[model samples]
Target: MALTTDTLRIGINKITDQVDPMGAHLNELDGRLGDGDLGVTMVNGFKNIAAVSDDLPDDFGMACMDCAKAMTKVSGSSFGTLMGISLMAVAKQTKGQTEIEWDRLPDLLQAALDAMIARGGASIGDKTMLDSLTAVIAATTGKTSAQDALAAAAEAADGALIEFFDQPCKIGRARIFGDKTKGMDDPGMVAIKSMIDCFT
Candidate 1:
């Protein structure tokens, strides 16, 4: 599907529906690691975004940016804020464009990565959302095929998550896992990657 405002809204909407379920799952796993609130946090962010869909801009990037601002205002959680930032970042890259072309998706994804990095401070393998996002970005950094790109994005996220097996957790609830987390992948990262897969 073309990345129009309505299409983007549908994308976020579908993902929004999954947010609570995904968040709950992530939180359950987090309880095994840290605060166990990551799921709740994500759900709250998406919930807020869902509430504002009626006001979304017609342009894809503008819509994303608008939603980002709305999420930032509506959400009180860290994950919520981060989501808004990433959305806005993608939107930022498309500010000058008349439309959201498939050709620009790579840059948009990278912009989200940049935003995530600048705002979240998570690294390449921090057992954070970055792992999934990084994998997606790296896989289709400049490739075409919005569908393939989205697919590659999800696949990369899964692959990046595998690193958690032996890699150390520097951020998120997994950081508290210590030894227990060694065998488990970061649930939030997994969900983020999984959720992104839906758009394809």
Candidate 2:
């Protein structure tokens, strides 16, 4: 199956439903290492994205850009900015397309990951959501169905969390905490995991 604007709308709704309830918890996690507004960023970002869902164009690339713009409108934090950048990267690749095949998801994700790395200056081993995205790209590379891709992505995201839980964050504000971040979850990674869970 292919993904279109309808898929985007449904995905946004699912993610918003899941993220709304976890906002406070996300904030609590960020509080230990950063400004503690990660949850606020996430909550507001998805809310804005949902608000524009119905208005998105038939072109999936343009629709993705609209979602990215909506995200940037609500948040200027590092995480939020990276999210926007990633969406824009995907937009560039899919521009004018009415739909994208599920098999192309890995390439789109890779584009997002590469853009985030270039713009955010975060490496794969940094114990951030980039690591999670990297894992998802690998896991979903050959999957050709939305259900299969989502399940693989969910497992990859969760695995990323477990793999990095004991490692110290190596970038952004969380990195400032050094060893204190070792046993703690990276708020960005957790945010990614939470959203991926909604799809599953």
Clash count, candidate 1:
1
Candidate 1, run of 10 with poorest lDDT: 70-79
Clashing pairs in 2: none
Q: Residue 64 of candidate 1: its Cα lDDT? A: 81
Error of 2 at 33 (Å): 0.6
lDDT of 1 by residue, 18-77 (tens): 677677787787677666766777777677777888887676677787788767764334
lDDT of 2 by residue, 1-200 (tens): 68998998999999888887788889999999999999999999999998998899999999999999999986446788889999999999999999899999999999999999888888999999999999999999999999999999999999999999999999888888899999899999999998888877
User: lDDT (CA) for every model shown?
Assistant: 0.72, 0.91
| lDDT measured at residue 112 in model 1 versus the true structure, 0 to 100 | 86
**CA error at residue 181 for candidate 2, angstroms:** 0.9
What's the lDDT of the predicted structure labeled candidate 1? 0.72
Best-performing candidate as measured by TM-score: 2
**Native-to-model Cα distance after best TM-score fit, residue 29 in candidate 1, in Å:** 1.4
